[model samples]
Target: MDLRVAAAVSLLLALATTTGAVTFNATNTATGTIGGLRFDVAVGLDYANLVLSNASAFIWSSAFNQTRPADRKPVDAVTLVVAADVSGAAAFTAADVITLSAPYVGNYSGDVRTEVTGVLFHETTHVWQWDGQGHANGGLVEGVADFVRLKAGYAPAHWVKPGQGDRWDQGYDVTARFLDYCDSLKPGFVALLNAKMEDGYTDDFFAGILGKGVQQLWQDYKANYDA
Candidate 1:
């Protein structure tokens, strides 16, 4: 018998072949154009489609999809991994994630509709956001994501309160509110901050925007809010 065949026969005959294990790698298949970006979706996957589709829309709307000096591509090839149920919850990692709601057969509308669009606006910001080469503030990271959601016109209705949070970067809705306030003081403030973050992030960048350190700016923000 051939050496390979002999080895296989020995293994099959030994111990009645009781114990064994096998692993599978998921294959991704690309579908139709998603907001002008093509994607190879993972089979039997749910959330990745939702998130990547929304990111495509935001980039197109924001004009990031257009050719620019940055040479950033509208949609980076996405890798989808389903880990735990992330619906109605926050992501703990830097990777972009989405959890599917009931599949809407027709056009997306209403609250859940907006939440899908909004969360991706928030999450995909993580995908593209620069973090001072991994040295950015945690609060600022959360704030920037929420800020993108805010700008996307998908902020939750209850998110209108300007300033009532404990800290400046309380994350999510709270930090979003503070960013809105900062924008009121300086038009294009968030845009400027985002541009700065593209290169680096620090409290000094906040000072460049507000004429003071972020801590002092937070103090002023609180005083104004309290007034």
Candidate 2:
């Protein structure tokens, strides 16, 4: 993986992934490489688009609890790129685009489609979720995205067990586990918090949603699982 040159991009006229005005596109630049070949064999463009479309619907319905369009960031299209590069990670989303590391795809030993779909669920949350107008905690932002993935039933077995994080906003699976606990106390808790974040983020949002600060909730969350 010395250098990644953009492959001939095709604006895939997606299947039924598009709803009304929104469109989804994908391009596999590494199709000639081993990793890219695996991606095509395990997860093709049609399947990837399906995951992206279904993930978006899942986040809107479950993660946001059907929050109105005003609460959402308006992105009419999303593009996913499978590149011939070693990102040292699975995948990442910047704005409306998702980049999957072809090297990772090539090396996957198990259900690659499921794994990639799970990664899409998490990254798709980033595309839709607010970042507190760039005023939110990075950990919380990532945690919320992971929480969405968790709810989507895509949380990998390697994820930390519930109540195992060192802090409530520990980010990723750790914070995602904490958020799950908070959601249990008050259903739709995450949706409310995300709504509040549309303007800005504050720890007080926890108090407003669950009548307790995040720290106390985190402790209680841990105590429940301490067997």
Show where candidate 1 strays beyond 4 Å: 1-75, 79-110
For model 2, residues 6-94, the per-residue Cα lDDT tens digits are 12111121222333356778889999999999999888998788677777767776788653444468888889999997578899889
Question: Model 2: runs farther than 4 Å from truth?
Answer: 1-20
Residue 214 lDDT in candidate 1: 75
C-alpha local distance difference test of each model: 0.53, 0.81
| TM-score per candidate, chains pooled | 0.60, 0.89
Model 1's alpha-carbon lDDT is 0.53
Best model number under lDDT: 2
Per-residue lDDT for 176-212 in model 1, tens only?
Answer: 7788788878877776676677567677888888788
